[model samples]
Target: MINRTKLCSTVVAVSALLAATTNLDAQKAFNSSDHYLAQPLIKNIYTADPSAHVFKGKIYIYPSHDVEAGVKENDNGDHFDMRDYHILSMSSIPGKVTDHGVALSVKDISWAGRQLWAPDAAYKNGTYYLYFPVKDKQDVFKIGVATSKSPTGPFKAQPKPIEGSFSIDPAVFTDTDGNSYMYFGGIWGGQLQRWSNGKYDENGSKTDLGKADEPALTAKVAKMSKNMLEFDGPVRDVQIVDKEGKPLLTKDHNRRFFEGGWMHKYKGKYYFSYSTGDTHLLAYAIGDNPFGPFTYEGIFMNPVEGWTTHHSIVEFKGKWYIFYHDTQLSGKTHLRNIKVAELKHNADGTISMVETYKK
Candidate 1:
């Protein structure tokens, strides 16, 4: 027969050993040494349209997952068909990218069908709101918001899209004075769609090939209300002009606005940057305020292998980085991966040209 006291002691020791092992596994969930070292910040899966935010001292990157075209039975070929987003993060400590997992997927968003494109996130009163664009049941592109308590979240999607906001690439900028602004628009010609005799006009008001005189391909910016759910004021145009106040994209000038409008304030000046559509080069214009008569500064980044170049800029630990995407990974245009590089600004406040990482 066994001693009862000895047996009880043995059982307690085994239980303590098992508990300790479980805690060790939890702490080792992320492999810090295996973190991505160079440009394509993530390697396991494809990510695109990186909207980065500096939250609570860590850099949280919200990017669209590039799902291959033939994933479904009815999948179209060589087209953008993204349906979800994942929140990726890193801290001041090097080589530690935490995969926060799927923050918001199309399945979680009721109104969204397919095409979950570029997204942006903002924090207010302890709640983090994610703003994304999706194709509604009516097949029109609309922007909606999702909220969560954590920066990397299983965010709850709102019931409807933001009223009066249409088009793609929804970016929110919070000013220094606590005032928030939202910038969005796309399809260069669509932005230049004019008002003809009170009706919608499509390039009918063009002079000098709709470039020199008329501000074609201009993005829109508006003030957001306290809740950020609705626009607080009328949307205004972000006019694009050259340093000499001439049209940035004239018949003689090939440079023009395509899509992917992102805004950031550095040294009290607002930098409105975007990707030149079809051409794929990333460029920018600077203004004194969010509502801009921005002067085109020139190309900000060399074009990536992909047809699109959606990006976001953030200052983390006194270092500025530009987060964008490229087609180097999957070797296909639609299947792109997010990348980051040191973003330098000239002494005069203009952005320095960013060289793409080949590897």
Candidate 2:
């Protein structure tokens, strides 16, 4: 009794209408901008030590986690003992977050069978490299490298640690000359070295680069072997000390210098950003070369609302931005959350930090 041809046509029209409505809903969701700057992007209930890198138009964050309810706990009573790194990737635009859960886990690799912390990732050519610090049961901390063909990856580590150095907080920088270097170290001191093939050789060492009274900041350039891990340059020191000298102190600790070395190039000059004092406020210096004969610029941002900050900076979509962590959320473990701000360079050559917007 019913006309089959008419029924089929009516079904096709209804399907097309539904498809159009669904597309419009998606477009609206993607186009709407919400203020995410003050909100945690991922509400895992525990995320810290966030490191962000933009690869192929996507923003990837590798953060350290302590424990999650559903996850099994190690003997230390932590869900994961900062021994594993997790990757979360999202669109650079607001309202677009795509989490590839637990992209890389230390348990997946035998070499770094213990702990992973402070992960930094960079992409070159068709390969993505993740640099992070690991620890074995012996409590010896070392830096390690993993490579994947994609940003969201099952990263594979080398047979052993990369430089064979007792180092932590590894930061990778590829300079204007196409040379790559790794700057690391914290509570002890920080070092800058050339990275080649798969190794790091000390081009220069800073026993006390951030000592408040030091006259100048110094750095020496070195070459590594084809393996890209050995050093071939001299150990040089550049002067970086303030003549007047301001003593940095915290409630429970005496302040020295050194921590979180992040560098960027703008308008033909290089800026090296770091943190200092017991409060861990953000500070910076400028040098003519990546290796420096540098001068301390001064503090860019101090603790706001009694929260200490760490150093992390990046340039996104032609705009310069600084990404640092604050203790406002969780106090005990430095349950650091990432905050961004626009960076402004003053006419007098000083820089200012501005709070970031999510929209």
Candidate 3:
């Protein structure tokens, strides 16, 4: 039996803690004892693009299942030939983590083409929704959804992809008002650059290379409809701007949206974080609302060991943490592993720059 009252109280405490944060930027780095950063969470199987969430009292991780597929590595992300998803859960951090085995796979998806990229999950009305981005038979990437009664799911697919969904890395964030919005998009092999013209193009637009004058590409976000199966409105671009209120240009590698979009609320502000792929850094922007004209804040995690810098931020048991991936498992980019560490938020709303744990 679960203690609903205790869970509710703990969740409230966590929000209060974040809401009450102050300019504690000088706070020392988290001592090693507080996190499981010394090694990957699961050793038997390779995993990446971890989307960690708190369901009830336990922490549930919805991660893309990385496999040692011999597909050649290329700019188009052909090497990351993942075919399924494995849901993981833990009673508490730095504690026993359980791999719930195969929750969803390519074979089970009739419309799926190949390479199940990053995925995220959400729970509503006693059902768990698994949102994933994958290619179809035409080799065009589109987002899809699956459902299960239990958090560790053997989810049943919806048969067709979400009509207006595209790109990779589907992150669903339910706001305080209970409205759920999804943030998604990525570049390179993820095929976001191909959609620069607002429509899917196999050859990509002529501006795909991104001239110095053009604004850096943007990520896509849309609100979940009442059915939770489709977008509530036309997908919109998540504007990443500068302090002066100008969009970052395409040539700005240091601060731009490359891939891996995640949204989290802290002190009533929305933080939109992503990977700066070419630079291998995880940066973020802040805005007043879910669909934002977010101003670029700064990088949170420095360049990681892996070629990719994908992550998720979550508040678990009164503390905040980052769930990210690295290529340390096999020293190969495609064969990556998931890791976690304490993420500090200053009272001034600035995030402390985090260096990847070397141990």
Best by TM-score: 3
lDDT by residue (tens digit), candidate 2, 1-359: 54545644554465356435533443443343342334445555456556677777767776665443344522122333554566777665344555666656777656664656666776666777877777644444566777888787778876666644444566566666766556554432223222221334444332332222332222223332233443335423333333244323211121233445566777778776665533435677777776764566777765422123454666667765566554334433234455445577887777885433332
TM-score of each: 0.80, 0.67, 0.88
lDDT score, candidate 2: 0.53
> Where does model 1 exceed 4 Å of error?
1-38, 71-78, 188-214, 250-254, 357-359
Off by more than 4 A, model 2: 1-37, 68-80, 93-95, 188-239, 243-256, 304-308, 354-359
In model 1, the number of clashes is 0
State the lDDT of candidate 3 residue by residue for 22-81, as single tens digits: 112111122232232446899989999999999999999999888878888776888899
Query: Which candidate would rank higher by TM-score, 2 or 3?
Result: 3
Give one digit per residue, the lDDT tens place, for model 1 in 139-163.
5567899999999998999998987
Candidates sorted by lDDT, descending order?
Answer: 3, 1, 2
lDDT of candidate 1 vs native?
0.73
Question: How accurate locally, in lDDT, is each candidate?
Answer: 0.73, 0.53, 0.84
Error in Å for residue 326 of model 2: 2.5
Each prediction's RMSD over C-alphas, in Å, is 19.5, 19.5, 12.5
Error of 1 at 332 (Å): 0.4
Model 2 TM-score? 0.67
Error of 2 at 218 (Å): 10
